[model samples]
Target: MRTNTTPTRKQAPVINFACPSNQSGLTALIARLSAAVAEVEKWAPVEDRLSLEFSKTADKPKVKGGVTKAQQLISDGEPVLDLPATDWFFHTRDAIEEGRAKALAEAAAEDRAAIEQRYVALLADWDAQEAAYNSKKPRGLAHAKRMVSKAHRAWSAAEAAIVDYEPQTLAEAHELLAYAGLDGKRVFFTPGETDLKTIMRNAAAAIALHGLN
Candidate 1:
């Protein structure tokens, strides 16, 4: 006669894993970097257009108006209208244009410089944080919880396979459950084995009964 005996599996040892808590900090840093890059892109187009406009009309005066000798006389309450209409155009055009071009160029240059500086700093901080996050191993209760969740998912999959097998007898079902990683030792059911709505109605009835009591 031949006999078959079930083999006992040895218990596996637990491993300690490390979890980094700076994930949120790293996420914030990445968000900052994205915002900084967006700011640079936003400013680039306006600055470029302004710079190009100034460059194209470099010879032309940019600023249009300033205090003229005639305007000054008018401001001084002199009868300027009595004199030939002041040649306002010839006196101020060149000076105003030149002043405006210079001002536009200077402002664009300053803005571009500031954007570059901020972008570089954000890039550096983001890179450092990302590197730190990558280097650390996941640890602690959070890691344990993740592992437990994974195991639960695996068990659920096993249960699904067992259910699909459609064993006719309780023994056959228990055997399939055992094959699918369940020990077939314990069973748990919600009170009254009812659906959610029924459970809720029962809870309301219990509350009302307690009130009457």
Candidate 2:
């Protein structure tokens, strides 16, 4: 019972989301923060090695001469008594946490920049579509039908949501037209309406056409 037909329409991925774009939302925020953590870990080999070896049991582990390793490493030689390994470890950990905060801030700013570019480009493209459709000088019916789709794209960008309407019947089409500021009474012309039938075939034209205007 399979049919050899292919659908001819596709919705943009951004249309599926309610945010400003596919890349801005709570999900994207978490993703960016998670990526920052991975980036930090990927590059902090020295810190990773130190954490694995140190962080453990009872009292602070002391190196030669009653001094901890953190003090010796920070000074590169003699122990810094005032800055013991315990204190130095906490200081270094806090600095790393600060770096993670900065990374997230920078990433959020980048997403804002990219989202602005996407919105600007979307509005420009829709403006061009409206112009192209208007340039065709279509009949009243054709104009209404084409503008329904074109107007929805403009509204979608403004509201950051899909507002498309695909009518399956004449009543539905008229509803869409009304919502889009189009009057449906002016459209006419259907097949075999060349003579007197043309003057009295409003409903025929409605059902015959793609149900617009």
Candidate 3:
């Protein structure tokens, strides 16, 4: 019976996400928050598994050749004799689970307050940013169309008649917003339900870009 004396460890799970260049501080913070969410997902499993390191080495000193009970048993049964395969599985599992519940309760108690703070801050920041974006964002369809470009009469005419011109994607919307000389790309993560969408669609976006050429 071969046994390894290597100790237990916890390796963090990899998270894959990156905020693009020239993004606002909010986007950078949110990218980090995504990683934190991943860590939260691994938290319970790491607690359940890596916490076993305490069971493995808490009582033992840092001395070489420390004989575990299984090692002692193997030594007692020379030449691999009486090396039983079946190992201990606790029969009184409910009590063990009760202890688990108590342990997890303690851990959650320590973390829950900070988690709440994080949530509150995130919402507050989002509101602040949305307010700022809306403050500068042009109001009304005609204003936005005029912002896009008044250089071409026919292009302006094409855009002037449209009712809904919001772009389909955030990037295009931002580009359109830039043409309108307004700030669009910085704060928003998803498509907004505003007049901004008017310049985002094909007809309006094409009109904004090519402009009746």
Candidate 4:
């Protein structure tokens, strides 16, 4: 059997190799497509004229000139070359106003702090003065008690003068003592003076008697 061994027709090379020209054509097509997509992306609501100009350049590769053509188109025009004047002016005005407002607020805060500090200092001074006054002043009730005790001692000493002086009533003794100046003024009663309880008892009796007569 004559074997038909035309080496089993090897599958044609899977990859169809492209020529340099084909590769260049593909690169140009890709670049054009990219430009067209970029132009569409640049379309703006505010500047319809600029968008239309970009679109025209993107669609006509001849007008585009090359990959840098889109950038050239944007850089060429009068409106494109000169930045939006109104936007620049508005931003500048806004920056100035913001700075002024911030400065004013800072000044106001400083003024408030100064006022508060002054008031706090005044209060501190007032508190110090009040503390000094309180420390120096004598207590009225304590002073009155001391005076009353001294007078009582004097009265007791005067009473001792009357021997066998168990006066029937404290009131009678108070009357006699008042005449001797022992009821009101301070005096040195003897060292072995009457006890506090006895003095108080006598004083109470004296007040009662004087009230009756």
lDDT of 2: 0.36
Number of colliding residue pairs in model 1: 11
* Model 3 ranges off by over 4 Å: 1-23, 53-213
lDDT of 3 at 118: 47
> For model 2, how does the per-residue alpha-carbon lDDT over 96-177 read when each residue is reduced to its tens digit?
4453455456667657566555445444544554455445432343434334433333323322111222334576445433
- TM-score, structure 2 vs. true: 0.17
**What is candidate 3's lDDT per residue for 54-159, written digit by digit as tens?**
3453332111212234332345546654543434322233433453455456766777566556445444544554455445432243343332222122222222
lDDT of 1 by residue, 54-154 (tens): 44543422222323453223546556544333333222334434544554566766575665554454445445544554344233434444444443333
Best by lDDT: 3
Write one digit per residue (lDDT tens) for candidate 4, span 94-130.
Answer: 3444544554566766576665554454445445544
Instruction: Score each candidate by Cα lDDT.
Output: 0.37, 0.36, 0.38, 0.36
RMSD of 1: 26.5
> What is the number of residue pairs that collide in model 4?
0
Comparing 1 and 2 on TM-score, the stronger one: 1
